[model samples]
Target: MQRAVIPLKGELTVGDDYTAGDFFDSVSFRGVQLASDDNMLPDSLKGFAPVVRGIAKSNAQITIKQNGYTIYQTYVSPGAFEISDIYSTSSSGDLLVEIKEADGSVNSYSVPFSSVPLLQRQGRIKYAVTLAKYRTNSNEQQESKFAQATLQWGGPWGTTWYGGGQYAEYYRAAMFGLGFNLGDFGAISFDVTQAKSTLADQSEHKGQSYRFLYAKTLNQLGTNFQLMGYRYSTSGFYTLSDTMYKHMDGYEFNDGDDEDTPMWSRYYNLFYTKRGKLQVNISQQLSEYGSFYLSGSQQTYWHTDQQDRLLQFGYNTQIKDLSLGISWNYSKSRGQPDADQVFALNFSLPLNLLLSRSNDSYTSKKNYAWMTSNTSIDNEGHTTQNLGLTETLLDDGNLSYSVQQGYNSEGKTANGSASMDYKGVFADARVGYNYSDNGSQQQLNYALSGSLVAHSQGITLGQSLGETNVLIAAPGAENTRVANSTGLKTDWRGYTVVPYATSYRENRIALDAASLKRNVDLENAVVNVVPTKGALVLAEFNAHAGARVLMKTSKQGISLRFGAIATLDGVQTNSGIIDDDGSLYMAGLPAKGTITVRWGEAPDQICHISYELTEQQINSAITRMDAICR
Candidate 1:
C-alpha cells in the first residue's frame, strides 16, 4: 500500500531504439520522485527542511536520536506529532526525543537540528525546474526545447552542495557538486561539468567532465560502502543530448570517414560515451546470513571500437523457511572479447511454512502460497530456468495470483498473472492481468493506474496518493462517508480522496455518521491535517443542509433563562445556557424563520419567535418545533 507513482515509460530496444519516459512526485523544489525512487539530494543539493513537532501522552514509544545514533523509531497515537521524515544530518545535531510510556514512563526531548551555510533545514529547500518538448519519430516534425535546473544545499560542516543546468537549441550545460563529512574516514564527492556546442555552423563542441564519489560506514569492518563513483571525459565531450542530435538536419557526415561519419547511435553508442567512465555501488552486512551487493559500470572510448564493461554481484539470505539469492553478471563490448557471463540462483518458499498452520484463524481468511526458483548460467553455453507460483487472496494480501515457467533460449515459457486490490466504500482499486506463452506465441498484458484529486467538492478518483494527500471537501453532502479513508465516499460532486496522507504528520479525518444525509448538518465531525512533502491538502467538511429544530421557548410566560440568547437571522444562532426544558437544538434552521430571544437586563426582556416550515419540514428527520415568546 505504499502509494504515489506517476511512471510512464516505454522502451523498445534491441537496437531499435524507442524511448519515452515520465516520472513524478512533487512539492516543487524539484524534490520527490518515485516509481522506484529518487531524490537523494538533488534540487541543487537540498537542505533546509524543518518540521519535527511532537507530543504523546500515552501509547508512546518514539525514539529518534541523532548523534548518539538511533535515527528514528515509531509507534505513536495519543496526540500531536509531526516528524517530517527526518534524515538530513550533516552535523548540526539536536534531535533526541524519547518518550516510552504506556505506563512504564520515560521522557526526553530536544529538536533543533540546524543547517545554514548554504541554507537548508529551515524547511529544507530543494527545487527543480523543467520544460519539455523533444519529439521524435525520426525527427520529421523535429522539435526540441527541453530545459532543466536543479538545486540542493545542506550545509554547515558536513556540507553538501549541488547545481544544475541544461538546454537544447544549440546546446549548453553546467554542473557543480561537493559533498563532505570526513570524521572517521568516509564520504567524499566532487563534480564538474561544462559543455557547449554549435551544431549547424559545424565545429564548436567544447568539453569538460569529472566526477568522483565515495561513501563509507565500516563499523569495524561489518562494512557498508554504498557508492564509489568515477567519471572522466576529454576527447571533446559533447553532451547536451549529444549536441542536439549530432548536428541535426538529417545527421550525415563523412569527411575522414569512420565508416561514413557514424558519430554514435547503437542507442547512443551504449549510453553516451566520448571518453572515460566508471561507476560502483556497494553494500554489505552479512551478520545473520544476509546481505552483500556490488554494482558496476565501465566505459572508455575515443574513436570507439571497444572498452565497455558491466559487472554485478549479489547475495541475500534467509533460512528457517527458505529464501535466498545469488547473482553474478559480466558484460564486455569493444567488439566483444567474449565476455558475457551470467550466473544466478534464487529460492523462496512459504506455503504456510509447509502446512504447520497457525496463521491465527478467526474463522478462515488465511491462505498463502509462494514458491520461486530461478537458475541461470550463461556465456553462450546457455541454461535458464525460472519457476514461480503465488497465490494470496485477501487476508490483507489484497488478492493476488501468479504462475510462471521458463526454460531458456527463446523456448518453453508460460506465464499467468492476476491481481486485485480494493479499499472500499467508493474508490481505491487496482486490477491487473497478464498471460503469455512462447513456442507458437501468445501474449496478453494489462495495467491501469489511479489518482485524481480535486477540491471545492469535485473530482476524487482514488488509490495512488502517497507523498501526502487530502481533498475531501463535502459540499452538498453527496455520498458522505469518509472515516479515516479507504474507498472514501462523497463523490457525485461532494469530493473525496483521502488517498494516503502523512507527510508532515497529524492526519486524521473522520465523518461517517452513518454516511450523513438526513437533513445534513455536521459542523465538524473530525479533521486534522499536517501535509507538506508532496502536499495536496484541502480537507474542509463543514456540512450544512436545512431545518433541524427542537425548540421550546417562553418569556412572557416565564421560563427563559437557563442562559438566554438566541438569534437566527441576526446570526448568533444559539448561545450559552438556555436548556432546562427551555429546549434548544437548532441546526441550520431556515424553513422560514425568525428567532430572537433574550433574557433579563430589562429592555422588555426581548422576544420575537415566529416560524413557518414546510417542504416536508425541511427534508425530514429531526424537525419538531414550537417557538413562542410573546
Candidate 2:
C-alpha cells in the first residue's frame, strides 16, 4: 500500500485521506523513497496502495496489482488509510511494480528492487589449517633439526589430523588422530603415536616409545557413557626396565631436569563414566599403588599423586532426595615420595534430620585415609572425618547457611566453619585448632578463613501496551486504540492522536494516552530508538485466552508457544530480556533453538492466539513443529 503524509500538528493525524485515485504519488508526499530492508515493509502496505513517494500526498489515489491484475484499488483522502498490508505470492518470478501520482501521472522518482531470496542452508565448508616448526642448535653433537605438518577438516564425519617429527639420522616417527561423530548416536575418537631409532643396534637400537588412546560416548542407551582407554609405554624393550619415564597421570606431568632418573614408568588405564542427575565413574590403572624390588634391594616409594601402582575405581549415584559417592585410588610410587600408599573413603547423606527446617541439600560426609606420606620414613596414617549441612532460607532468598566440621589423626585434630550468601552480599568465617601426637616431635596445627563477595544482576526497563490486539478508546486516535476514563474507541478522529511518548529515561518506553500513532493491523509496533546494527526482542500478547505464551525474539525472529503451557503444567512466567528491535538480522535462532513460551498464570489465558512474529522466528519454530526439513 502506498501512503502520503498529512502534517497537521496539534490536530492529531490518524489515517491517510482516501481521495486520490492513486495509491502512491510523487507529489504532496515529501521526503519519501524506497524503504530499506530495515523498514520491513508490512503486507498491508504492498497491496492496492499507490507508491506514495516522498513528494506525493499519502491521501493520493493508488492501485495494488497481482500478476498484472488489480487486487485492490482505492482513493485515499484525509480520512483513514492502511499504509501496508500482508503480502503473499504463490507464483515464482520477478515482481514488477510501479508508483504514480494521484493524477495518474508516472513517478520516475521511486524504483522497486528485483531479487530472488534463497533458503538457508547448512553444511557449508569453512575451515583453516596452521602448521609451523623450528629447531635451534644447543649441544650441536647430532646437528638437531625438526619438521612437522598438520591439516584439520570435516563436518558430519568429524575431523582428523596427525603430525610427526624426525632427526636427520633417519629416526622416523608417526602419530595418528581420528575423531568420528555419529550425531545423536554418540562419538568416538582415537589417538596413537610411536617413535623408534632409525639405526638398529646389534641387540636393539634406541628405545621405542608407544602410546594409544581411545574414547567413545554411548548416547543411544540414554546413559551418555564416556568410555576411555589409554596405554603408554616407552621401553627399549631390550631389558626388564631400561629407560621408561612419563608423567604418571594426566595431572600435568613435570620431569623438571635430565638429572632426574626415571627407571621406568609404563601404565594402562580404562575410564568409564556417565553423567546425569547422578554422576558415575569407574577407572583402573594397571600399575597404580604397586611396589617393585630392584636386585632384591628393596626401596619403598609412594606416588605424590597416584603415579604409582595404577588401578582406580570410582562411582557416584543420586536417588530421590539423597546423593552419595565412593572412589578408590591406588598407585605405588616405585621410589618417589609414595603418595599412592594410602586408601580413602567418603559418604554423603542429608543432614537435615539433625537440623531444623533445613533444605534438602543437608549433607554429612566422613573420609578415612590409611597410607604413607612423601617425607615420612615410617608408615603413617592420615584420615579426614567431616560433618556438614547446607540449606536455603525459605522466605529470605538472601539467606543461606552451611557448616563444616572435620577431625583426623595424622592431620589437624579440630576444624569448623560456616558461611552464607545473601542477595549480592557474601560473607564467610572459619577457624581451626589442632592437637597432634607425633612420633618424633610435637607439631602445632591451626587454620583460618575469611571471605567477602558482592555483585548485582543487571537490570533493563522496557514495556509495551495493548499491541493492536485490542482497540483502545482514547480521544484523538489514528490506526490504534485509546484508553482514557471515557471508554475504548477505534478509528477516532476530530481528537488528538500522536505517538505515545516522544522520549524515555533509563531505556523505558510507555504509550501514554497521547504519545503514539499506529495503523490497522499494526501490532507490537515498536519504535527502537537505539539504532544498533541488530538486536533481540521479546513481545507478549496476553489475555484470558490460551497459554501464557512467551516469545523469545528479535526484529528478525520470534518464538511462540504451541504446547508450552500445557507441557509446563499450565503455569508460566513471562520474564527475561530481548535485544532491541531492528537489530536482530538473523534468519533463525542460534543453536540453542528459538525463543520459548508457555501458558500464563490465569486460567482463561491458555488458548491459541496469533501474534506479530519476527522473520527470524518463522525459520526456527518450524524446525521443531515441522520436522520434515530438519
The sequence of per-residue lDDT tens digits that candidate 1 reaches over residues 407-474 is: 54433444333445555544445554434344343334444556776544356776566656787776
Off by over 4 Å in 2: 1-149, 155-174, 177-211, 216-225, 232-307, 317-320, 337-382, 392-401, 420-630
lDDT per residue (tens digit) for residues 288-342 in model 2: 2321111000111122223223333434454543443343333333333543323
Clashes of each: 27, 100
What is the overall TM-score of model 1 with all chains considered together?
0.29
- For all predicted structures, in order, the TM-scores are 0.29, 0.31
lDDT of 1: 0.57
* Alpha-carbon local distance difference test for all models: 0.57, 0.27
- Worst 10 contiguous positions by lDDT, candidate 1: 18-27
